[model samples]
Target: MDIGVALRDLGQVDSTALIERVLGFDEQAWVENSYRQKQYDVHTLTESVVMIFTDGKGWPNIEVSKESGWDLLADVAMPLMHKIIERHYPPGGTIIRAMAAKLLVGGVIKPHVDAHPSFHVGHRIHIPITTNSRVRFMIDGKPNRLAVGNAYEINNQKQHSVMNKGKEDRITFIFDYVPPEQLQRMQQMQQASQ
Candidate 1:
C-alpha cells in the first residue's frame, strides 16, 4: 500500500520471545520453505521461516494457509504480529503473509516495488529482530536504518531495497495485512471483472 509515505514507524515492540525462538531454529527450519526464493529469484540471498502465505491467485477469493514454519514459530510469533496489528490496524483484516526473513551478510535485494496484486492493498510491516550498523534499507531512494525493538510499516507500492553489509545476518519479522473494508472492495472489483 502507498501509505502516503515511504515508511511509517509503528513504535516499539518486545520481540524477545520471537527472537529467541528464531535464533534457536536449526538450519533445516529455515530451508523448510523455499517458496520465496524459488518464486522470487531476487530473494536468493535471503531465507525465511514462513508462518502463513497467500499468493492471491484465486482473486476475489484469496487462499491463505499455514506453512511448515507455523508449527515452529507460531507460539511466539503470533502474539507479536497480532499485537502490532490490533494496535494500528482495524479488526477483520486478513493477514496474507507472515515470516521471519534473514538477509545474509553481503546480501543485496535490488530496488523494486512489490508488484503482486495482494501487495497493493496489504500493509507490509517489519520488525527488526537483529540488525547491525552496516545494514541499510532504502525506501523511495532515502536511506533508512531500522532498529531493533521497533516496528515499521513500509509502503510496498514504492520502490525499496535492502543491503546487509554487516558481518552478521540481519533478521526481520514481516507480515502483510489487508484491512477489512479495503479487502471487501478489492474482492468486489475482481468479482465484477470475472
Candidate 2:
C-alpha cells in the first residue's frame, strides 16, 4: 500500500481546548509507564524519564503505568485522529493504543524500528503536540522534524528514533492503526504458517 497516503494533515488540532485538556487534565486517571532501556538513551535509570500508555508488560523500566495514562489521553486529539483513521485505516480498525510521551532536555529514543517481529504490517502515526528542531522522527534512516500543522505516518518497520537536543520539553501523541486486510493477513499467516 501507499505508505505516503497514510500521512495526512487533519487541520490544526493544537487549539486552546486541546491544550487545556492536556495541561489541566489529571494524569493520575490514565495508565502510564516509565522506560529506561539503554537503547532509548537512558543515562540515568534512577530518574523518572518516560511515561507511556501501553498494556504495561514488555519493557523492563516502565516508569508510568498504562492504567494511569488513560487520564493522559486528550479529547481534542480524538476528532483529528478519527478523521485520519476513518479515511485511511481499514474497517473494524481501532486505535488499539496511545501514548503521551515526554522527552526532556537530554531525552532520546535511540534509532529503532516501531514494528515488532510478530506483525510485519499496519501503520504507525504521530501527532506532535510540542516539538522543536532537535526533536526528530528518523524514517528509513532519514531524520524529520515535527512541523506544526502537520501529521506524520511513519513506516515503523524501518529504523527510527527521536532526539531532543533542545532544553524545552517535547511531547507528541502517538498511536497504532491496523488495516482490516493486514489484520486478517496476520491471522491467516499465523494459522497457516504456524
Which prediction has the highest TM-score against the true structure?
Answer: 1
lDDT of 1: 0.91
Residue 34, candidate 2: how far off, in angstroms? 2.3
What is candidate 1's TM-score against the reference? Answer: 0.96
TM-score of 2: 0.69
Q: Write the per-residue lDDT of candidate 1 for residues 18-55, one digit (tens) a residue.
A: 88988898889888888888988679999999999987
- Per-candidate TM-score against the hidden true structure: 0.96, 0.69
Question: Candidate 2 residues 81-187, lDDT tens each?
Answer: 67677765656754545554556676766765553432245466666667777766565667666665556676666666767787776766666665777656656
Candidate 2 residue runs with Cα over 4 Å from true position: 1-16, 25-32, 35-66, 190-194
Poorest lDDT segment (10 consecutive residues) of candidate 2 = 43-52
